[model samples]
Target: MKKINPHTGILVALAVIACWFASLFFLLNWHFNWSNPLVYLMVFVQMHLYTGLFITAHDAMHGTISPNKKANNFIGYLVVFLYAGFFYNRLYAKHHQHHHHVHTEKDPDFAPHGFWKWYFSFMLNYVTIIQLVIMAIAYNLLKIWVDEKNLLLFWVLPSLLSTFQLFYFGTYLPHKGEHDNEYHSTTLQKNHFIAFITCYFFGYHLEHHQKPGMPWWQLYKVKE
Candidate 1:
């Protein structure tokens, strides 16, 4: 399982990224009815691919993407950059602080106030000069080959949606409010399908805190 998980992880990460941009390519080129609602529906589906990309990076932060540290970090950086501008080391540090100091001021993800506040805080903390430069380069390079609308809807907008998805399901909903448990995490949605759809079973967040070393795919299986 250990060996297969890393191999599988990289493949899955690449697959999600391909799904997002490839679908966007097709969607942008295809002439569709102006009022077609399914267009938005499909865009939201592509947003799931964005969510998957970030989730893969999150797994890499936990060092579960591969047994080989270098390979894991490589894949993590690729998928995260593909998602949008983000510094892996910065995210890693903040996430570790979150786990170690959950619900406290020191917890980078402290969300006692509510969901929106936490989401913005999380997003703001991930940005840095290096990340901005990387994003700018990516934007210029992608614009050379991709349509502006496609880039916004598929690459940029979806990445934005993915942030709310990650924070709402992965952090705020899980760790909000007063909880007496050691981890202070919650299982807001126990339905397996909902958990899977929302954020790759991250809705079972207490299980995550209970088993930090476990991969996101296996979080739901934990007896939280």
Candidate 2:
């Protein structure tokens, strides 16, 4: 698979991070009426930014973001770690495991039980020690400069919300149940809009498993 132009891809990734930083700054500086609904809406928008950061890292994991392996891993590490903190190597390993084993018992994304338990299992494996350390450092650093309410509402809270969004739309919905196929995954919505809006085409689990080399933007063209 041909990777995206390294310059373009890196620029786009940097633009997103810049936008997120700007949004956080604006939210921190501007005091809003607590009872207003727009503030909450803005938070969800920020949540999607977090999810986009994850998806960006995910592309790098598949080696689709850059032709150069070093650049790919570097971009993946930066974006993913910036998304509420994570060790990029751990994420790469676990995600590769899901693609290899998929719906089987060996799959890290799978839990044989109900949604709550499965989600718990998914999250347990996702968290890493480096993430905790980064979070602590970020909290301490931000305490000196940013308001606690702004930090929680604009940064920490969106990250937590994005976990559910990614887990539900990306993992649980598409690969939750039993499957007979080789990959043991399913295509979710035929609606391209929903697919992108949900999890950046991650809902197309079977397509992704079949053509793991393809980037997120191209997955919508995949056919059953």
Candidate 3:
């Protein structure tokens, strides 16, 4: 695999971080009309931005976000913290374990059962008590100033929904069935638009596992 310019990854990561916060701020302050379709549209839009946060952090974990280790890890920590108060070092360790172990029992990202079962196992490995406490504290504090409904609909729900979007596209589909390939993962049919919307081009799962150093934005290049 060809090495991507490290600055490209840095720019994308920063852009994603900016977008996530901007969208969250806008939605949290927006006046709502549940009857309007646009209100619903904003929900999914925010959801995708949430997924982008994780993808940016995921790239940082791979050292794709910056050549400097400290810079890369800082971005990773910031995004995960913003996303859901997740611990970056815990995620970083587990993610590398997933890569090394692939679809085996040792892989924290994998499970042998169906979608729900696998999702539970996956969440158990990543979600922590500290994360819950942080989120709970943030929610209560933010709601004192922000609209509770907006926080629930835009901030809270979107983050939860984004988890399913990511798990379905990035984990369950790719690693569910038996794979004969070396990566033990599968790819979606080549459609970059669908790929991006689905999980930031992570539906190209084999390409990702094959070239672990590639950033989310450049995964389509690996496909080509």
Error of 1 at 94 (Å): 1.1
Ordered list by lDDT, greatest first: 3, 2, 1
RMSD of each: 2.5, 2.1, 1.1
lDDT, model 2 = 0.84
lDDT of 2 by residue, 13-98 (tens): 67777887788789877578889999999999889888989988988989887787898889899988889788898889999998
Greater TM-score among 2 and 3 belongs to 3
lDDT of 3 by residue, 35-151 (tens): 989899999999999999999999989998999999999999999999999999999999999999998889999999988999999999999998999999999999899999999
Q: Report the Cα lDDT for residue 194, model 2.
A: 82
Q: Please identify model 2 stretches exceeding 4 Å from their true place.
A: 1-8
lDDT of 3: 0.92
Arranged by TM-score with the best first, the candidates are 3, 2, 1
Can you write out model 1's per-residue Cα lDDT over 32-93, one digit (the tens) per residue? Answer: 55488886787788778789888888888988777789988997878777777676777888
C-alpha displacement of 122 in model 3, angstroms?
0.8
In candidate 2, the residue pairs with backbone N, CA or C atoms under 3 Å apart (3 or more residues apart, or in different chains) clash, namely none
